[model samples]
Target: MIKNFTVFKRKLSHVCNLKPYKDTKWLMPNGNPTGLFVYNCVADQKVPVILSDPHIATWYSCGPTVYDSAHIGHASCYVKLDIVQRILKSFFNIKLVTAMGVTDIDDKIIKRGKETNTNFKSIAQQYEYEFWLDMANLNVEKPSIIARVSDHILSIEQFIKKIIDSDMAYVTPDGSVYFNTAKFPSYGKLQKMQDCGEPLSVLKRNKMDFALWKGPKPGEPSWPVSWGEGRPGWHIECSAMVSKLFGSQLDFHAGGVDLQFPHHENEEAQSCAFHNTLQWANYWIHVGHLSVKGDSKMSKSLKNTISIPELLDKYSADTFRMACLMSNYRYPMEYSDQMMQTAEETLKKFKFFLKDVYVYVNNNALQNGVYKDKLLDDLQNVEYQNLKFLKSDFDTASCINNLLSLMSNTNNIIKEKNGEYYPVPIILIADYVTTVLMKFGVTLKENTEDSVSNSIIDTLVDFRHTVRLNALTRKDKELLNACDIVRDKMKMIEVQINDSNKTASWVFTK
Candidate 1:
C-alpha cells in the first residue's frame, strides 16, 4: 500500500529567506520569465496570484501518451515536476495532491496500434506498464492520481455536452466538435499568438480555434456521445480530467512549455467555459523542453531520442536523475554522454560521503553520549537552506548542488575532528539528506550489515591503493584488469545488499 504523509506536520516554519514577489516578475536571475499567463477568453491577460496558503497546493501534470517507450524528454518533465512537489511538501509542510493523466485515447495510440497490428487498448496497456517501470527505476513517486482518459469517457462526454449547451463549442458538417474561438474572444493569451510575427487567423478558424471533440475515423477509438461516435480532443482530455479530479478551480496546472499554445490554451477555454469561472488555475507552471546534442527539440522521427530504460540500464537511475537536476527546471537541458558521466561521478562522491558518515555515526554510537547542539544547528541550517531554495519556485538544481556542498563541508569537518563526539546530529543530517534524496528519486539504501559495508569500503580503498602501487611499479595491464574485476564484484555485492535491505525494511515497517 502507498503510504500517505499528508497528516504529518513539521514544527519548523515554512517561510523561505528570499523576498517574496509582490507583483508578476518577468525575468529571473537567469533571464527567464518566472511568471506565466493563462488565456481565459481568447485574449491572454496576465493574472497575478496570491500565495497565502503555504500548506496546501494541488498540481496537475500532463502525462505521457503511452503509445511508445518514454524518452529522456518525458523523464525530464517528470523529474522537474517531482522536484517541485517535493519542495512544496518539505518546505511548507504542505500536502500536495498531484495528478498525472495518461493519454490512453490519443490518435497516436490508434495509429501506432494499427501499425503494430495490435489492439489499441492492448497497446496502451503495454506502454503504460512500461512507463510505470521506467518511473519506478528512476525512483519517481507515483502521482496522487494516475487517471486514464479511457476510464473517464463519461466525464469527457458530459463536459463536451456542457460546452455545446453553453454554445462555446459547435459541431462541424462532420461529427467533429470544435470550440468556437469567436465565442471566447480572449483566446491566444497564454502563448501570445497575436503578438507572434504570423497572423493569428492562419492557424485556425479565428485567432484561437481548436478541436474539442474529434469525429471518429474508421478503426479509431470512439464513444457514443451527443455528437455521433467521436473521441475527445487532446485539450479536452486534460480539461475534463482536471475538472473531474480537482474541481473547476485548481491550485496549479503544469506541463511542458511546448504545450502552452493550442493545448493548454484550449484547455483553459474549455474548463472556464464549462465551470463559468475565471480562475481556471491559481498558478500555471511549465517546464522547459529537453534537448539532444544542444538542440531544443527531440523527436522520435529524427531517431535522436534517448529512452529512459536504455539510459537507466547504461548508467544507474541515480546518475540519470542527477543529470536532470544539473539543469534548472525552467531551462532546457542538453543531454550527452559527457553529462551522464559527470552525473555518475557526482553520485559516486555523494554515496561515498554518505557511507563515511553512516560508518562514523554507527561507530560513535558504540560510545554513547548526548547529541551535540552545535552540529544539530549546522545540520538544521543546511536543511533550512534546502527548503528555502526549493520553496523559491522549486529551484531543486540549485538546492541539490548546495546540498552537495554541505556534504563536502560536513566531510571536512569530520576529517578535522573539530568537535567532541556528538554522532546523533550527524546521523540526523544524513537521515534528512537521505529522505530528501529519496523524494528526488535517488536510490539510497541504509547499510545494516557492518561486515558487508566494511568490506565494500575496504575493497574501494584497496583498489585505490592498487592503482598507486601499479603506477609506481608500471604494471598497467594488471591494475586495469584488477580494477574492472573489483568494480564488477562490488556492483554485484551492492545489488544483493540493497535487495536484502529492502526486504528487511519492508518487513520491519509492516
Candidate 2:
C-alpha cells in the first residue's frame, strides 16, 4: 500500500507538469476532465471551470440555514455537490478549497426560539449539530471552511460599509442598510430578470432593492455598527464570507437551483459591488431540487420532508448516494418509496456481481487462456475510455450507464468461459469498476479483510446446524428464526453460507 501510494503521488506530480486539456478531449483512459465543465446558473449554459491558480480550485457553496433539522432535500443537494468535489480532486487532480456558510442568525431561528422559549443562539447551535450529523450519515464531505454568520459579524459590517461607501447601498434612518438596485445596472443579471417583479418593502428606495442589514427589533440579536445596532441580512453574510476567504473572485459558486433567483442573484450583486469586479465567481453550479409527490418540493414548511436519519434507518448511505447519482445533477429528483426501492435493488445487483468476480479470482490463479474473446475485450476498452468523456462532462448518470455496460460485458465473458478464462482482463474490469464507484462513494465490500481462521467458521457453522436441527425437531418458529439470524449475521464477518435440504454449510470468504 505504501509503495502504491508513492507511485500514485509520483504519477500525479508528473500529470501536474503536463499541459492541461485544450477542449473536451480526454487524455486517453485517464478521467481528467478534458476540461472541467459545470452548469453556470447565470449564464444558463455549461461553462468550463478553469483554475486561476496552477493546481488549486476555489469554490463557495451556500449551506443550510440551520434553523431546523436537515432533510432529504438537504442530503440530495450536499451529496451531489460532494460527488462533484470528489471528482475534481480524485479524477481531475485539482485541489479544492471550499467554504460553506451557516446562517446561524436568521429570522427563522428567532421565530423558532420564541415559540420554543429557547435562546436563538441555542436553537442555531442545536440544529447546526444535527445538520453535521446528518451530513456524516449521508457520507457528504465537509467543506474546507465552515463560516457561520455569528462568527463573521465584524467582517460583514466592514463589507456593508464598503458597499455603502461605493454608493451601491445606503443606510436607512433606523440604522438599517439596503442595496440600491438602481445604482447597479447588472443587479438582476444572475436571475436574468427583465423587470424587478419583487414586491417593494416600505423603507427601500426602489422596488428592486433588498436588505443589506436589518435594524434591531425588540428582543432580537443585534451587532453594533457605527450607525446603530443591527444584524446582517441573508445576502450580505455570503458576500462577506466569500470575499473574506477567496478575495476578489472564485472558481465556482454552488447551491440548490431554488437559490438561483433572489438569494443567489442578490449574493452575486453584492459580491461584485463589494469587490468592484465584473464577476465575483467564474462559474455557478446549482443542484436540482428534490421533490416529494407531484410538484410539491420536499421542504420543512410543507411537512413533506424525509429526514436523513429517517432514510438511513431504512437504507444504507451508499444506497441513497446511488439514488442521487442515478439522476442528472442539474435535474430534479423525485423522492419516493419506489425510487428508493429501485436504488436499493440496483446497488444490490452490482454488489452481488462484484462478489462473484472476487470469488472467481480467489478460486483460480492468473493465467493466459487460448480462447481470447475479442468482442468482450474491445467492449471493455471502449467503455473504459467512454468514462473519461462522460465524467468530464459532469454526466454522472451516463457514467454509471457506462459502468453498467462494462459490468454486463464482463459477466458475459465470465459465463462463456465457464470459469476457465484468463484472469488478467477480468481483474482489470473489477479494478476499473471499483475505482469508478469509489469516486461516487459506493465502495464494494468484496475485498479481502482480516478475519477468523477457517476452523473457527467451521465451528460456528456446526453450532448453527445443531441449533437448526433442534428447532426443526421441536417445530419452533422462534428458534428457527434465531438460527437464520445467526447465518445472516455471519456475512458481516466475511463468511458465506450455502443451505442444503437438511443442513447448512459455510466458507471463509477472506
Candidate 3:
C-alpha cells in the first residue's frame, strides 16, 4: 500500500503541476467541454485542478437550496461531483476538506412556503432532510462542513459590511445592499460576461450588480440588520460560508455549470474583494447540465424534471450513479428511458457477477487446489494494474472496461476449472473489483431474485420430503396429487423436477 501510494504521489506532478502548463482541455470521448475548463493559479491553464497547497486539498461546492424535492438533473450534478470526490479520496489519498453550503433561506423557499402553507423554515428543513436522504441513497459523500445560509447570517453581514466599507458594495435608498460590479473591473470574469445580459435590478446601478442583502419584507425569512432586516443573497451565502469555514481561499470550488454564471461568478467576485486575494479558489470545477429528452434543461417551466425519489422507486441509487457516470462529466446527460434501462441492465450484470462469486466461494470453492501458483500470479497482475489505473485521471472509465474483460475471462476459467482448482484467484479478483468500485459508492449485493428462488426451492424440497412420507404410508390417490403440487410449484419457478418412487429432486431448467 505504501509503495502504491508513493507511485501515485510521484505521478501527481504530471497532472497537477505546480509550474505553468498549457494544453487544450478536450472531453476525452467527445468533442465537448469538461463543464469548467481546466485552469490553475500556478503554471499551465491546461492543468485540471491543482491543489493550492499542492499537498492536501480544500474544496467548496455550492449545495442545493433545498426548497423542494431533488430531481434527476440534481442527481446527475451531484453524482458527477461525488465521483470526483471518490477518486480524490480513494486514489489520490489526499486529505480533502470539502465544504458544501446550503441556501436554506431563499426566495424559492418563501414561494414553496406559501404554496405549501407552511413556514419557510419548515419547508427548508423538510426538503433539506429529503435532499440528504436522496444524496445518501445515491452514495454521495457528506460534506465536512454543512453551512446553512441561515446559520451564517452574522458572518455574511460582516462580509457585506467589509465590502461596503471598502467601497466594493453600496446600499440603496430602500436599505437594500448590492455588490458594486462597476467597482470590480474583472467582475464577470468567471461568467465571461461582456455586457449585462438581463434586465437590471432596481437596487444596483448596473445590470451586472447583484443583491448583497435585501431589506426587510413582511412574511419573509430575514435576519436583523442595521441596513434593514434581510437575509443573505444567493451568492453571498456561499462566499460567507467559505470564508467562515476555510478563511477566504479554497483549493477548488465546484458546482453545476449553471452556477458558473452570477452565482459562482458573484461568489468569486465577493470573495476576491473581501479577502483581498486575486482569486479566492485556485480551481473552478463544474459538472455538465442534465436535460430531459435531450430537448431542454430540466426546469419547472417545462415540467419535465424527474425527481430523485421518483426515479429511485423504479431504479436503485447505484443505477442512477451508473447512468450519470456513463457519460463524461463535461457532457450533458439526457434523461431518456433508454439511458435508465441501460443503466439498470449494467447494474444487474454487476450484481449477477457478484452473486455468482459469492455462491461459488461459499459452496464450491472449498478445495485446497493444485493451481496455487497460477492463481497467485493472475491475482497479483490484476491488482498492480488496478492500483495504477486508480492513481491516474481519466483512468476510471478504462478501469471499468478492464473489469468487464476480467469478468469475461473469469467466466471461461470457471467453466474450465469445473469447481476443481484454486478459488483464491477468483476470490482475489472479485475482492479487488468490489473494493475499487466501492470508492464510487457502488455496492453490489447478491442477486435478490436468485437468493429468494434458492431459499424457496430449499423449503419446497424439505416440505415435499415430509409430505411424501405420509402419502407413501397411506398409498392413497393423494400421493400423486401431493407430488403433482410440488412439481407444479417447481415448474412455475422454472425448476425442473425429477422424481423417483422413493424421493424427489429438482434442477433449474436449461
Candidate 4:
C-alpha cells in the first residue's frame, strides 16, 4: 500500500532533559537559582506539554497596555524574551510561534480615556499604533499574533461561560464574575505567596481571589455578556486570549517578574478552572524588572521612565540592545547614561576589530595559515559558552562576557599577525564576528553616510602617498596635481565625519 516508504521515513530527535539543576553562573555567581513552574493536568495527572515531536512551540507574552507609550522597562521585558525565542530556535533547534496580547480594555485604559476626553476605542488605537512604531524603531520583532481584547469579546465570553459552568466561577450581586479561590488550591504557588505577606485586597472572600469580569461603569469600555454590560478584568484578558488562541494548555507563558503575582496567578486560576485541570502552561518564564538610577524601579507614573523612541533618537538601537544584554535577563539592570556611553565605546572597539579582520583577510599579499584555525576555534567556543550560559536559564550577562572574551582574543590574534597575511580567511573571521554581534542586535556597520565617506577618505590618504612618491621620483606634474585634488577631498570628508560624530554625541548626551 505504501509505495515510496523512504519518503515517509521519520528522523530521530533528541529529547530535552527536564531534570532541575543548580545554575552556579547566576547574576551574583551564587544566588538562589530561579525555578520553573509546570502545570499538571488534574484529569490525566500528567503535564500537558505537546508530545515530543515536530511542531511549532508556542510562547505567549503579556504585552503592554496601550494607555501609554512603551518605555525602556517595557522594552527590557520584550528584549529578554526575544533572546529566549532566538536561543530556542538557534541552540535547541526548535520551531517557535510567539504571540502578544494588548490590553485594550482595562481600568487604566478607561481612566486614560477620561483624562484625554477621547472614546476608549480611539484612545486604544492611537496608542497601539504608536506602540508599534516604537517597537519598529527598536527593531523588536512582531509576535506571530497581536490579539487585542476588543477584537475577541465573544471568545472572552465563551471562556467565562466554560468556567462558570464548571462551578469554578460565580457572578456577584453587581454582575461581576469572580473566580472562587478556594476552588483552586494551587492559586498562590507561582510566586510562593505563603512566604510573602498576605495579599492586600479585602474585596474577595479569599485574599488571593481576583476578578474575572468587572461590571459595567459609566464612561468605560463595555461588552454585552451573559452577566451584564461589562468588560474583562486585567488578568482575565490574558487567560481568555491564551485559552482561545493556544487552548487551555501552553508550552510557555512569559512576562516581567512583577506579573507573577496577581496577573499570572489569576490567569492560572481562570485557565485551570475552564479546563478542569491544574496546569495552564508547561513553563512560566518571568524576566526581571529594569531599574533606573541605582536600584529604583522605572515607572511612568513615578515619572522616572525613559521612552523607547526618545532613547533611540539619542543612541543607536544596537547600543541600546547591547546595554540591555550587559545584565542578566532575570536580574535588575540599573540604567544610566554612563552605561550607555560605555556600551557605545565597547561597540566601537568591536567594529574596529571587525574592520581590521576584514582588511587583513582581503589583503592579497597576506598568507592564510597562521591564525585561521585559532580564530575559528575561538569563535566556536564563544558559541558554545553562549549556549551553555543561556541554557542555564538565559544567563545573558555571562554569555556576553564570554563573547567579549572571544572578541578580545580574536583582536589579539589579529594584532600579532606580522607575517604574510591571508586575507580570505581573515575576512571569514570578520563575517563570523559580525554575525555573532547581530544575534544580540549590535551592528558594526557605521551609523551614517558621512562615516562611510570618511573611511573612503582614509583609503585615499594611501593613494595620495603613492601619488606623491611618483611625483617626486618622476617629476610628474600630473601626479602632483592629483595629490592636491585628493587633499581637498580628504578635508571635505574629514569635515563631514566630524559633524556627524558631533551630532551623534550631542544626541546621546541630551
Model 4 ranges with Cα > 4 A deviation:
1-51, 194-203, 364-372, 420-425, 449-455, 460-510
Candidate with more favorable, higher TM-score: 1 or 3 = 3
| Model 4 Cα lDDT, one tens digit per residue, 356-459 | 56544544543445546766777677777766666566666787677667767765655553544445445665676676567665544455444345544555
Candidate 1 residue pairs in backbone clash = 41-186, 41-187, 42-186, 42-187, 43-186, 43-187, 44-189
Full ranking by lDDT: 2, 3, 1, 4
* Overall local distance difference test of candidate 2: 0.76
RMSD each, Å: 9.1, 8.9, 8.1, 8.7
Of 1 and 2, the candidate ranking higher by TM-score: 2
Best-fitting candidate, measured by lDDT?
2
Give one digit per residue, the lDDT tens place, for model 1 in 182-241.
787455556655443224443245544677888878877778886787888888998898
Regions of model 2 farther than 4 Å from truth: 1-34, 196-198, 364-385, 390-392, 417-419, 445-510
Model 3: how far is 185 from its true place, Å?
A: 3.0
Between 1 and 2, whose lDDT is larger? 2
Question: In order, what lDDT does every prediction score?
Answer: 0.68, 0.76, 0.71, 0.67
lDDT of 3: 0.71
| Regions of model 3 farther than 4 Å from truth | 1-55, 359-395, 417-422, 446-454, 457-510
- Of candidate 1, the 10-residue stretch with the lowest lDDT total is 501-510
After TM-score superposition, what is the CA distance of residue 261 in candidate 1 from its true location, in Å? Answer: 1.8
| Candidate 4 similarity to native, TM-score | 0.79
TM for every model, in the order presented, reads 0.76, 0.81, 0.77, 0.79
